[model samples]
Target: MLNETKDPLPVAERVVGVRLESPLVGAADLIKAQEGRASKAFAMRELPFRDLVNVRGELSDPAFVAAFAGVVGCEPPAAPNTVARSDHYDVLWLGPDEWLVRSLAPVQTGMLEAKLTAVLGDAYAAAVDIGSGNTVVEIEGTRARDVLSRGCPLDLHPRLFKPGQCAQSVYFKASIVLIPTGDDHFEIVVRRSFADYFCRIMVDAAASVAP
Candidate 1:
């Protein structure tokens, strides 16, 4: 007689109907408090719930590159401090062998990471969903650069740091991935742990530069 056996893998849990909060839950209130103190030429807001995946692999490996391209719809940026973008995602070069994949829109958590991991199977690579660990903050308008320059040490001159470029730098005490989205617009990807402090410091900086 043969005995019945249960499946070894456990079933994935489905969570639903839960309310979600962004890392900077109080950002709106903080911005409102600044009111006229903050510059009219500057604005700051959190782009919460974005999907972020940290991918690591050798770009020289054709198989690894192909696998990533097949899943992400574009080859990872080969140039240092550049970004490779597609309709759905933007791949930012973090290091010689590391890239941060950010979704243009909100996606089911871990969906992209799972697809990447599945396709990159047995290839020297790794895909980790870091969405929950980070949040995006957008600072724009005429005085945006001034606010950033107050604490960030990078050269904010347009001739030097143009669009489609990114760099890992520190904003005051918080480490951030800075991306120039337009002439006067920049996005900062910072850790959830530092979101509050980042907003407070940024607000203070904006107020300092107010006209």
Candidate 2:
């Protein structure tokens, strides 16, 4: 509907050409600038506007697992902390019975929710779209692990953490679902409310070692 050409918002809320946003909208630029002041050890940037859905289902129920697998086109991860990827989405395991599904393509709001609901029905499974409630940050550089390990307690060495791994853990003061996407890269999910604080933390760290 954005191409409808009519004002997207009511006339009272309209600004000639301004885009409505949150305080963190421009924080990425500031973080990038701050990273420039560092020693170029690693780099961090925000991955904005990803579709996220929080799912809780009965892992013991075959119907529950099959329902999501049909919609996601991949079986939900049953591991303690793992990730499964399909052509269109990444299903991250947060716990034995909880997972977070993220879409690779930009989708219309409510599309993911409706799609899952249709397949899930009124079963014991539950799915809640949380795309707007969380923000994803990517940290990767020559010494990405070194930089992240400063705040996170996880053992990021290749011997332990590797691709397709995901865990719910603390990063400094904020809680995050840390996903290892590559040997030198990670996707950290922080709550929107903590995004600003999280950005500041990474910026400060990246300043000492940005590349």
Candidate 3:
């Protein structure tokens, strides 16, 4: 049986799409677990073997792409960086001129964005801090894509959604960036304010996908 009520309680803390049948803590309970939450920010359980690096810069510069591509020894395709990696770099394009370079070790975000900006030189790029304004939720387990497909339009097929690939699109009416980490795992980047509402929609969507 499912709740199916207009306002079902949220499970999975900062994450929204938790299965109704699975044990979960309430949103308020999850909030209480974290210490430094005043507003516009919250944290969830750290995802295994993954770290988030947010970078902001003028994505308009042609040289910017070239330098990034140089690191990989091939031209970066006309998409974001989640689909390509060199030893440890997984670039996920966040916007036209912005990208999120992910790796196992945390790097200085400002320094990296600065390096790109300096390389562009007079190309006039600036990197901004978006860590507090967004939430990056990693969706794993074997059935993850099946859960995401209910609300996301982008193809989740492994052939189409290879690792090191990322896309920004609307999920349940809220805009988000989807980064594929594995055949079954995905990283969801969403704004802070809509986290709760988005989680609710995700739970409903996931429940519908449950067998």
- Residue-pair clashes per candidate: 0, 6, 8
Residue pairs whose backbone atoms clash in candidate 3: 16-199, 59-97, 81-91, 82-91, 82-164, 82-165, 83-164, 83-165
Q: lDDT scores for all predictions?
A: 0.87, 0.78, 0.55
Candidate ranking (lDDT, best to worst):
1, 2, 3
Best by lDDT: 1
Best by TM-score: 1
lDDT of 1 at 20: 59
- For candidate 3, give the lDDT of residue 129: 45
lDDT (10s digit) by residue, model 2, range 1-211? 2334674677445434544343267586777675565334566776766778988898788888888988888988887788899998899998888899988765543467778888888779888988777878877777888778878998889879998788888879988899988878888888988888888887776656555
**What lDDT score is found at residue 190 in candidate 3?**
72
For candidate 1, the per-residue lDDT at 154 reads: 99
Question: Each candidate's root-mean-square deviation in Å?
Answer: 6.1, 4.6, 13.2
Residues 94-151 of candidate 1: C-alpha lDDT, one tens digit per residue: 9999999999887766689999999998889999999988999888889999999999
Task: Assess candidate 2 and give its TM-score to the true structure.
Answer: 0.84
What are the models' TM-scores?
0.89, 0.84, 0.58
